[model samples]
Target: MSSYYEDSVTLVAAKEILASLVESWALFRLLCLSQNLWAQEGCFPIPIISATPGSVIPWNESVKILCWGTPESYLYQLEILRNSTFEVVEKKLGFQEKAEFLISHMNTNTAGRYQCQYRKEYKLSEHSKTLELVVTDIMNQDYTMENLIRMGMAGLVLVVLLAIVIGNWHSHKVPNKEDWPDFPELSRSKHKCQTGPLDKALRDTRALCGKAYCKPGNKKTLPS
Candidate 1:
């Protein structure tokens, strides 16, 4: 006849609450942008995709970054930085068919906001997305529901908490860039991502081109 059962249930509830916060924070606190564009105009000349490290990526875990672009014949270049200073922590040069990258052996140095740099034809293409990776000391924290509720204000707190339990239940991201499963196990691939903005743009461009040339009425007129 121990009171331990009450503590166990409380722990479960607490985890549910805080997990929700982590998710909502990830969804709303982010702004996705592409860096590939015309140099002088800074115009996004091509469609591309990528993954920015998110807060959940665990220590020593690997995250895959993917991206593609217009002028499908061109190559793709990828780079990673752990901070806003744009410090180069990892680099891959002259990659013609690289769409994704697996970040492994992550440590403290790898923990931070991650940005994916896209390059095409020596010109910068659109950036994929940006996300932050924060390592947690799960071993030291109790992190039950009550403790988590103490972390946020009442504003949208319930909704955010719900989102944490329901994320990935309603839909999946279009492969542009995101971390999944759990941040603590980031070194592994939780799922596969096949599409992103780059993939969508490539598909749209091809579809449009097909309509212009293959459709019935859009024929080119000869100069009379």
Candidate 2:
């Protein structure tokens, strides 16, 4: 009967009983009190840990992690897998002291995921939930003005070639109508600016006298 009572009073078993209840500040304080009260009641300290996964770290930069736990024995480490299958693994130690790691460059690959591993002096602690980071080519311009210009010129050439193939020709016409002559209107305007050499040849001789066309020695009229 004593053995059954001892097993029932253990701190591990006590915490297990507390786990079923919703966690809150009051509940946590009660469980802690129970653990302290049961120290003479012969039980190991229940392990507590805090870590963040599902976070993102950009490529080509340092990855930083933070982890804290009770009893001061919980040591944290961060690691990454190079390949998709995790066939290659990279690990580090002492994240509680220094939580930063640098990403190594690869020839082809761009993105990867990181995870935190915590241990109390074991080779592998339960790995954290995975966090993913994205990598991109800083060199490539996605949409450039030069590329758009080239595409537009190519499309214009293609359209012109198709029009030629479809038997279309454009008739040429000048815009300013005054630049082209109107012969009848110019001849009949009866202005000083309208006199021309070809028109002078067709006029009757009985018109009003002009000194410009008069013979030099025959200017005087004979009783007209």
Candidate 3:
């Protein structure tokens, strides 16, 4: 009777051990399956990114950077390249697999290469393609060389105008009598002015009388 009882106890113990081993194997298989599923879910596709109002923005203006990812994504991150390394600048919760980051009062500090990423649970998706942001304020800034050139041109124009005005003034001025060229009629008038009254009367009588009347050997009537 003792021997039969010992056999029964030993067989019962053996069955219990086999049951425990089967349960452990089943649990290990289930754990492996769950890990595979988690890994598959974590492997997400790369996200897409774009900027609104164009990637080129004016200083003090605003821009909207949009990122899109898989529907399962719950969080989105925006990163910028600074000093050759990427740093997260903003984050947003995903909605419909999309996220928007509004950057206001944009300046030189805000302009650079940017990227976006999305996270689903504990795994993050691959980063999106780089987008370049450009900020311009050329109209407002003063360039030394450009300003100097403009000033030099303006001064040159003023000098030219002054020279023209002076030339016109000099041209319009009345010339002195001494500056005028001498003519036969002017010389004769000057000679007349220098002559005496008796010479002037003799010249008038010769002018009124004919040359034949004035001749020593001829006689003719002179006009009254």
Assess candidate 2 and give its lDDT: 0.52
In each prediction, how many residue pairs overlap at the backbone (N, C-alpha, C within less than 3 A)? 21, 0, 0
Q: Residue by residue across 1-224, what tens digits does model 3's lDDT show?
A: 99999999999999999999999999999999999987786678789999998999989999999999978788999999999999999988745588999999888999999999998867788899999999989687668999899999999999999999999999999989999888756677787678888998898887866466777766666746
Question: Which is the winner by lDDT between candidate 2 and candidate 3?
Answer: 3
Candidate 1: C-alpha lDDT: 0.57
Worst 10 residues of 2 by lDDT: 43-52
Question: CA shift at 134, candidate 1, in angstroms?
Answer: 2.4
- The TM-score values for the models, in the order shown, are 0.34, 0.30, 0.46
Model 1 lDDT tens row, 30-73: 52222222243354444344455644655566766565544332
State which candidate, 2 or 3, has the greater TM-score: 3
**Model number with the top lDDT:** 3
**Per-residue lDDT of 61-107 in model 2, one digit per residue for the tens?**
34334433223333555555664544324344543432434444422
Ordering by TM-score:
3, 1, 2
Query: Residue 95 deviation, candidate 3, in Å?
Result: 4.5
Misplaced by over 4 Å in model 1 are: 1-55, 71-84, 93-98, 141-224
